[model samples]
Target: MTSPAIPFVASSSYPVRAGNRVRPLIDGEPAFRRICQAIEMARESVQVTVTFMWAAFEMPDGRGSTLDVLDRAAARGVDVRLVFWRPDAETERHRRNAFWGSAAHVGLLEARRSAVKIRWDRAHPGFCQHQKSWLIDAGADGETAFVGGINLNPHSMVAPGHHGEGHNHDVYVELAGPSTVDVHHNFVQRWNEASERLAPDGRWGAGSETDLPFPTRIPAPCGGATVQVQRTIHAGRYCDGTAAPGGHAFDVARGERSVFDQYRAAIDAARRSIYIENQYLDVPDIVDCLHRALERGVDVVLLMPAEPDVTLPVSPERRAVLDSRARLGAFANFMLAGLAGLGADRRRKPVYVHDKLMLIDDAWATVGSCNLHRYSLFGNGEMNVSFAEPDTVRALRCELLHEHLGRDTAGLDDRAALELFRRIAKENRTKRDAEDPAWQGLAFELDAATHVG
Candidate 1:
């Protein structure tokens, strides 16, 4: 299939490259199932980068814990490598161990005899290493990649459209063809730098100074779509290497904020519609651009969590979470909704909107770990993959709306679909206020100003 023409100008930070096949995997069941399958089929190696993980999370489908699956793959002679963010020493007391610092995680690794390599990477203090991706069969034919915001929390293991305690609505894309090469490149880049940090102590899972080699060239395209792998990486974090200037989809500089630039460009160029599903909607520049798109008669729809989860302190003092909520309360001129799930008992429960996604005019889309917050936009180490394929964007948009509205967006244009969503959301709010039994699985308007305060 020929790729659709992009109406907007592409950012120099992430130039569009062609020849990729991408499939949107909704919720944890499908995403994790596919991830395990790819690991099982790996011919050479599997590389995974995750910001947060829980030792308690077992695959809900009975395949065992995440480590078990990876161990099994490694036992088959597949090289399995993982990198998890190691919390700074000061903040370690208040957070769960994402690395080998905890006895349980170390014991888990020690028990497994497979040649699974794990590394702990430290990000710029006070920020997170918040990119999550999985690459299988790197540097070979049949290579594939999965990228998005699905974390290792048990809550994220729930299937789509189901009501469970701590239910979440998220997305991950399974990619094939040349796009996997970029994912492979990112993993190697981070692993190399992380190894340098570990070399001094000869600990933290960096057994040797030599790390995985960067792919000498981009892999051959296995399909029809085009992709641009983008990132927000601070300078000096990757001390061992730097991205040279030019047509590369990412930049290595003192402050490379390509993810933010891409979001601004995509929103500014939106013509007919804008659809977003994210955990936070508080970035000033992004909000301003969305407001302008609204003024231009673009239909705007945003989905966020009805209740913010501040279960852990993202900062030393745990004040950033509150600040984020305050910032979210200040947006205007855009239609916003808080999504909730209904149960068999007809109870309304918030379905945590953990997806970082945006669809502009059904012609452009992005999916990954970067949220619309200052920390994510300009401070953290984040990654996102975007494409200018209308059919793929439209299908993913329809699928998400259908899950949120409990009906298909059949025969509706992008603008019409958003408008219909607005109507259903308003009606659902009224029904909930009236104690109506039918207000089960609909999104309701959010009073951003009053929601937090």
Candidate 2:
């Protein structure tokens, strides 16, 4: 663990909020289950910022579908509002993964008479509105929020143990405290300026969609954690003259890049170890930061997808990762790894690690939708909350390690635990190569030098 004196990285868009409670909910089944229960119990409002949502996705245990949950909340006089991404020509290639308000979707909403208010937002050309969050009972005494990288697709909605075919491994953090005020503020900003708000068939539950007010007061302290909400907003995205709770008012015309800034700062301040699980680890600046950390004797583990969606041949993603490998593979203390699972056809399969989570020195950690890629770090809309709570951070690291290594690492220090992770991952890779199905866990080490290729 880091010294107790080490503080959380500062943020330009939000202030560090103390006395907040944060819980790490691993995997989609656990995350969505809690989010659904919160929606069902919501009495004031259910607000969601969706980036990618498959139309056929549903809540576990027959709770309901995404729209069904919103409809049920609305049917009970609870306000339900959703801001969904609407891809433009540049982002049209992502439309298949997003529930953009197309003619078919508009017709479905009209036919279902969905009472949920909806707004569509278009990102800057070639960028995306990639935030995935759920804020329940906004501004109420019991307000809570869910933030992470989980998407609404069957491939991402699997159980925590990962049965059947390989599924997307992801994480979501549930938060309730003064920090949640920032989430409420972000939703209001996006909802008020959603593109196509005035277009025909642009909004569902028309005549009912109303602009939201910024939260005037912070929620009371709920726990001991100190939290700071961070974001990546493209320049000129939101011009609202509002500020996050306890934060100075920025024009926001210049945008906010606090997520990227925090990541760099955390890696630079590492005293013992840095554990990060992200979809892609191809950001040049981040790779450089990790290189510096490893040079300073800080053990680092970067867990990414065995089969990254970003690394399509001849794609820009491919070039970026190859560049990262060339720079970071020189450090012996740095281990690059990926996860795999048993497929339904009784074959080894790569499970996409869609988690955007990082733990530094077992004292600071962050969880949200911001990837370590240019799109998420600079252009796309993103959200993450960093917390300085030793117990919470250490517990989350242990939980994730157990899931990946199938062993309890709670007794080990952060550095020792990650060293064990490297050994086990390499062992698992050997077993996989031998076509053995008896590997301890889903993790396996990847050759940083040629993994991208």
Candidate 3:
């Protein structure tokens, strides 16, 4: 079956840049602002892929609203195309309250009437288009792509302990280099595939076919920066009523393998140091990887939420995994204790890694939705971006390691180490509780654990 032609710009006509400082937007406000700035500066087309989107008029800085801006941009002859996951109408109530409602659908409907294109990613039922990114036209100069875990929703931008609190930690990268093209290409592929499936005879929704128009070519930014685009997709399940002739589509195991392969390749390439920040640190393979790296004399530091979302009662199997994680923590403590013994005066520290990020060799870094757990790496639809920019990567690595070591200098006394660890645990726990009152018990447990010994 011949697929629809994917829109593309001639590579030769546009100039590309390399060796640029890829800024990491740490908070949601910065991320949203950067996105708006890129959109405002867009001269031709805009493409956005997200897991969820909420329609709201009230946003920080009164930056006019998400829906209003998108509509206006489309009206100005800017080719705007958005691909998003379509949640079941039944779940709309819960989703609407959680922040990301059917805004993508609503926004797309409005845009479609205005001659803008919209596509729903019906790749796999129950699985989502979990990538959060946007590509804006930089004219013939180049394009800017924002890739990260931040969903385009209001709840994500609020502070950690606000009235509508959520565990909204994320990192986004703004790319104005060669990597942006690759990111743009990926979006085109997914959009085209979605458009095909959403056709009248296609298998997306039981309705009349709709065609979304998009640009053929986008300009490339001229500079020196290399960025690599990586993604995870669900291939086994047939969401479009199409069977995998090779039987490869029936094997859910292959998706798991792909995820593991990507992660292991990245981990094996690390030289010097690996810093990660994640929501969960319970995955055995990931833990083992760090342990092996530490044995090889690589500096590994992780920042994680003090308490995980296992606050609601869990199954015996899940409980077992959590217990095993605690045991692993004990093992890490034992290793650190041995290291402390050798130094005599230096303090020993237990690793409580979180925050789902990793910076290696001060040149390569990765940030995304994949956690250090089997469910995230192997079971669910996840997205991550990995790139190398010496200055930015090195700066982030230094900042994280500085906090881990308790100072800018190398010498860290035992007292300081203990205090630092305690503070981290305490702050994370407090934040978790403030987000969810049910997490109060977890906070207490964290405090007790830090106080013990």
Candidate 4:
């Protein structure tokens, strides 16, 4: 029995549009391969913005570093601009020596001097410029834009437990069409903003025609898809309103309504189902919204990392979040158990939810740096692209739910066979001393000394 082919919808009907000819590329490995291929094929320009970039990171082919690929594009006369979160100069040596011991900052610096235009986004004090995206002109024929959670760093690419492995999971979308133009416009906006702050003049940076080898205006080919860009930031004046901050600085709070607010609305508006995948699943407001959705008969599912990367001594604040989430999960299970026999209930047996992502109605999706937590919603600077293609939405929904049910370890479902799993999860939380053979030994244990306040 073959599954029905997923449908694709237009952007105008949805807040974000989806392309008709897009295909799903599973896992970071294949995704990176596509990006490398696109970069190699680029004829005019390539613009990359990420939270972090390591000079030694390589593709699966082991051919070159991400920086090396950019340099090659530049040597071939392709305009290559790289922007990343600028670490504080005061703390730079400490981070380089401790966290990134093997980093080649000097090599990257020399590469910039030759062909690449590298800029650091020195935005807020504790906040970071946490957007990960790439825009490349794939020859004079067309352009491609990638937006999602993957960073251009070694940890992001390497498998877990390797020398520089980051136990993280992420997604990126490769888009072509009129949407590519919009993505390019976003890159130019950030580039100018970042450049201005770096300049001695304390204003946005300006680029000249001779800055690179490729023509500045890469003409758009006919008959491609359309794309939309959305972002979030903190509200404040830079340098006490005295000097502009370098690298993609913007008044995030003032630019639009809070990203959290948008997420709340989407969760509330969900008619059929909501699916999420993330690193942290600890946001209270989002949990409240999900509770409400469950009450109204909307199905919710989430996929989260079995283990958090922050394995250091747990802070009181972090513990409070864990406790809150555990309690929330318990409440969700209790509610679903009571409502198990209600209505037609084609909505799956149990209410399922996880951390990595959120899909609504199989019509809308969001993938990016923001987690389902307060820091990502209101504290840290984060960016995510909300997608509205029917096919994309449905496919993501299936992948996540599939993982949840144990039918596929690679995918998880929010509602399918959730009650049994919830009971198991509850047992794990309650019985710390009891070791089960099936347990992966990766579940988090919240300490009792932490206070919510």
Model 3 C-alpha RMSD vs. true structure (Å) is 10.9
For model 2, residues 160-246, the per-residue Cα lDDT tens digits are 667345588999999998999988999999999998788875688854467888888899999999998889999998888687667
What are the clashing pairs of model 1? Answer: none
Descending-TM-score candidate ranking: 2, 1, 4, 3
TM-score of each: 0.89, 0.96, 0.67, 0.69
lDDT of each: 0.74, 0.86, 0.50, 0.50
How many residue pairs clash (N, CA or C atoms closer than 3 angstroms) in each of the candidate models, in the order given?
0, 0, 21, 36
Cα displacement (Å) at residue 301, model 2: 0.6
Report the lDDT tens digits of candidate 3 across residue range 23-100: 777656767877887777778888887666665534457776675666678778787777666544433433553223
Error of 4 at 220 (Å): 8.0
lDDT of 3: 0.50
Looking at candidate 3, the ten consecutive residues that score lowest on lDDT are 334-343
- Model 1 over residues 272-297: C-alpha lDDT tens digits? 88899888765657766776777676
Candidate closer to the true structure by TM-score (higher is better), 3 or 4: 4
lDDT of 4 by residue, 324-403 (tens): 55554443532211101011422111111112345666666666667666556664556555555666666765553333
Could you say which candidate leads in lDDT? Answer: 2
State how far residue 124 of model 2 sits from its true place (Å): 0.9
